[model samples]
Target: MDAIVLLRDGLAAALTPGNLLWAFCGVLLGTAVGVLPGMGSAMAVALLLPVTFQMDPTSAFILFAGVYYGGMFGGATTSILLNTPGQASSIATTYEGHRMALGGRAPQALGTAVIGSFVASIIGTLVVALFAPTMVDFALKFGPGEYFALTVFSFVAVAAVVSGSVLRGVASLLIGLAIGLVGIDGQSGAPRFDFGSPVLLDGIDIVIVTVGLLALGEVLHVAARGRNAPDLASIRAGKPWLKRRDVRRSLPAWLRGTALGTAFGPIPGSGAEIPTFLSLGAERRLAKRREQRGGGESEFGKGAIEGVAGPEAANNGSAAGSLVPLLGLGLPTSATAAIMLAAFQQYGLQPGPVLFERNGDLVWTLLASLLIGSVLLLVINLPFAPLWARLLKLPKPYLYAGITLFSVLAVYAINASVVHLVMLIGVALLAFVMRHFGVPVAPALIGVVLGPIAESELRRALAASAGDLSILVDSGISLTLYALVLIAAFIPLVSRVRRLRAERRERETTGAGTS
Candidate 1:
């Protein structure tokens, strides 16, 4: 009842004409930047931080909330249509989303992604509003050991589920780990693979890696295919609306993804990447089960609607989930949240238990603004999804040329360093070779993302326990995560063995009948 009263007051405050206009501007600006590779919500907020200094706190927060949600929505647009992810969180969507676009289901993919993001954003914000304190308590329980276990779980789940072959997946993951190890060691302050260059000491940026591997690599790969390359412009986009059948298929996936995102979002350092990939793995497994029962065909390797829906939902939900810790504990789980934290400090407001007591109205108003932002995002983006898909209709030469230009600009924009451009070319070549050999690039990307986190957490746990191995599993959270890892790894092996046995039995029966 108290919550209801506070929300009512918040809505009354947030629905003002000035606040509504700010929300619209924020979402509009956010979507524009998010559609560009390497430019995400964090950059958008960072750029606008100074402009907000003159604005009221409530209006400023409302604008930031709009940008945060809008970025999530825009990231999916490119990942589905162009095979380029606007940010790391959208990478999971690219695995199946691009394939769906190639199969001429671009409109459906975009539709599912938009609806799923909207659903997740609304639910995730409400979850934050109603359960922020409880979620903060839960997040505080994680130690280094638990964090290590969580990374391991993510590794095994993505490797086993995303790859067609386990060996290839492991190889790609190792390549990523090696790339992640290029900079100076954080613990020892010693260079590992700097190659005698000052630029190498700082390590390769994630933006460079993502753009090189997904965007530039794709351009090179297509160029290598010569005239025989598939013509994307020829692919006919069907109706611009999601059919009832598509919605029915996507609704369950959206809910499951939202649940996963909400559950993992509050954990510091977990980020949207883990939950988005986990959601993809879960949907893949469920599709396989449904196919085995003769209920439906699994379209995982092709472009399944569930794949786009689940991961996109998870990405937005995790974005919303990260706010729980940010508001209640004053902890930033992501880059954008970190900037927002600075914004809070600039306003002389400290977030914690006292925050709710001291500025209860402001907190509720912020949450209400998030809800309003979500509605604006859907209204602004849904009508134009089909128009976004029409981007593929451009001539291949122009399309590829545009991609190359953006790829170069994205890398050069990092620090205006020529060495990064050289590294981008190198990474693109590596990606091209991997693609030629049918090696999955997703695992490598995951490794680059989670490898350092895993290593840091493992070392922290060991250092804390004075080199005691038992300390890693001493906590219930760590133990449970390891158990989940075992189950995830074991299930695939069991299925492979059962299938081999069935094949052998069938062969022997055929031989006996022939005799």
Candidate 2:
């Protein structure tokens, strides 16, 4: 009865002409932003944060959420058509998407990407609706140590070694940790690397960090490659249609990916990023084995519908999984969720255990809105993909210059501080340098966002225990967790050395052949 009430209320709220318009406008703008190279959903959301100021909070958040959903959908447009993933989530799509485009089946590929993403998103939203109650119950029981353990578990569970090599992946995680350590210390509240800059006192904003590292850093890297005035010829899909074989092959893969992706969703930091990669790797290996047995690796690389299906499901599943901490404990796992967290805070609403009691309608309504958005995305995106794909062809200078202008202006608008604009530029430069060194920027952003909370929690845990060291090891759960962290933190180094050895062997063979 309560759920029904909330659904009715939420539907009423979401379906209001004003809210519906915002949702539609959000999706359209988000899709266009995401389809453009260097203009990811994160950057788009960050850039537009200022625009939401004049809007009602409820309508604003609905729009933001719509933008997030639309951005993910739009990411595949460029990845398939141009071998360029609009964002990180679409990287795996590029492996198969570009191939499908090359085969003169661009329409079919776009259809699979959109349809698969839509179905996966719907399933994921349903999973959230059905499972959130149980997850909240489970998460409410977590102590600080348990939460810490969950974070470690997230990093370990999502390791690429499970899909590719474990060591290299672990290294990427450590890089994130190191980046998280920049700025002020959470517990002591002292600046770490402020370098005498007053703007560093408040610590790095997650939005700035992500925008700086992914967008600004990418721009610098691309500029370094001297591809300054690149021209694009749009790819076309004539009569896009999925064949019976495509359907048969993709359904199983979609189901498999959803199951696999959902299972890995709740381990703290684990999300679609790793799960998609792992799913793709699994599909590739399975396809190879099947080929060796005379089935032939038909769709594995050439936009095999399965390739599109698995990663899409994994990404959506991960998004649903990410809500676990946000609702259960007020922890935001992904950058998008972090931005949502800020939105929640703006309305003086805190998300956590009490959220259900205080704003059950809002919470349920939010969940219901997710389902609505998923359906809307599938309906809109599937038919207009070629149009979406052309969004990638927008002039880079105009787009990037506009982004640069907006990022600074947004930062200033938020605080009305000249210092913030300076801070944004500084981060942009730091992010660019960080990328030149091959460092993964996501962890750093996660670190900056999570660092303060983790520190605060650690201190609270100690104060509650009256500073006894035993508190850290008091529970079997904590001991087990620490041991797991130790294992995860070291695995990447070991994996890297192993990979180097394999490469060396191949190199030696080539050198000997030349001799």
Candidate 3:
């Protein structure tokens, strides 16, 4: 009954003309950035953070909610049409989306992706609304040791699972930790890595680093690569239409993907990308099994509609799921969620159990806005698919030039400091180097965001136990978190071995055929 009242009030608040206008604009901006390669909702929110500092928190979050939904909607647009994933989560979609495009099923592919995202987003939002309170209760039980263990689990899971190589991921994480350490220590009065500069004493601003690494770094990298944009001239950009057969195949896949994605969302360090891959893998295996049983024709690689629907749903579902921890525990599990956490802090608000009690209106309003934005995204994205495709044809130099300029202005606007510009350049350069070396950047961003919390919690837990290290493992929650971390860390290794064995078997079979 309380949930129902809140939802009613939330709908009333969110439906105001001013808030609705903000939601529309946010989704529009999010879609624009989402259609562009290497730009995600994270960059959009980061750039808007400094600008929205003085704005009302509820309205600002409404704008952000629109952007979040729009990014998911528009990401699939580029993946299907240009074969270039606009964001990391869209990578799985590109595997089959582009092939479907190449096979002249672009309309069907686009239909599946957009509709699938809508279904998943709805399911995910409902899950959040229903389960967030429960998670808050769970979070209220966490001790310092448990929180510390959770952070460790996040660090290890991201490092081991996201990157192509665990070593590179750890290297990126260490870089973030180093960045996180530069500010003044909260427990002590002393600065750690200020290097005798007053400006450094405040530590690196999250806004500056976020904009520098994601926004500025992308601009510089694109410019450095020179004139090789993919051709979208041959791509179709029409409205997506689904036949009965297509719907039949897509519905089940969409549900399955939503389940997998939503389940992974609350787990620290596991993001949308993982669920999409898992969804795709499951769909592939299922399709193969169907074919083996002589049940029906399987389109495993050649424009499979299941491929487009399932992974896209998973991607959007996980995107929604990431909010669970952010709202309930004040923990961010993805780059976009991390930026949103920063936004919460910027507004002098902390998201957790207390947020619900003290700021119930804001929480419910934001949730209501997510649902509104999801609808807006579906409405806007469907008819605007052709327009979004045209976005890819915009001159790269101009597009990136605008991004570069905005990034500079946003960074300088934060503190109006020349030092920030310098820091932006330095961080952009570091990001470029990391990208060049195939290093994963998400873990670095996560580390920077979570590092301080982990450090403080570890210290507090140790202090409570008189500096005894065993206090780290005292809680049942901490032990479970640690165990999960080990499992997450080794899953990749086990998968790699299984893959190698499968390849060996394939080779043996091929050899026998030759004989």
List the candidates' TM-scores in order.
Answer: 0.96, 0.68, 0.69
Runs off by more than 4 Å, candidate 2: 1-23, 29-65, 75-110, 153-175, 227-240, 244-249, 256-308, 321-366, 392-515
Question: Each prediction's Cα lDDT score?
Answer: 0.88, 0.66, 0.80
- 2 or 3: which has the higher lDDT? 3
Q: Per-residue lDDT tens digits of candidate 1, residues 403-512?
A: 78877897898889999999999999999999899887888888888899999999999999999999889989989999999998889889999999999999999999
lDDT of 2 by residue, 181-204 (tens): 667776677787677877766665
- Which regions of candidate 3 are displaced past 4 Å? 5-117, 128-132, 227-369, 499-515
Q: What lDDT score goes with residue 87 in model 1?
A: 76
Better of 1 and 2 by TM-score: 1
Best by TM-score: 1
Q: What would you estimate as the lDDT of candidate 3?
A: 0.80
The predicted structure with the larger TM-score, 2 or 3, is 3
**Overall local distance difference test of candidate 2:** 0.66
Judge candidate 2 at residue 85 and give its lDDT: 56
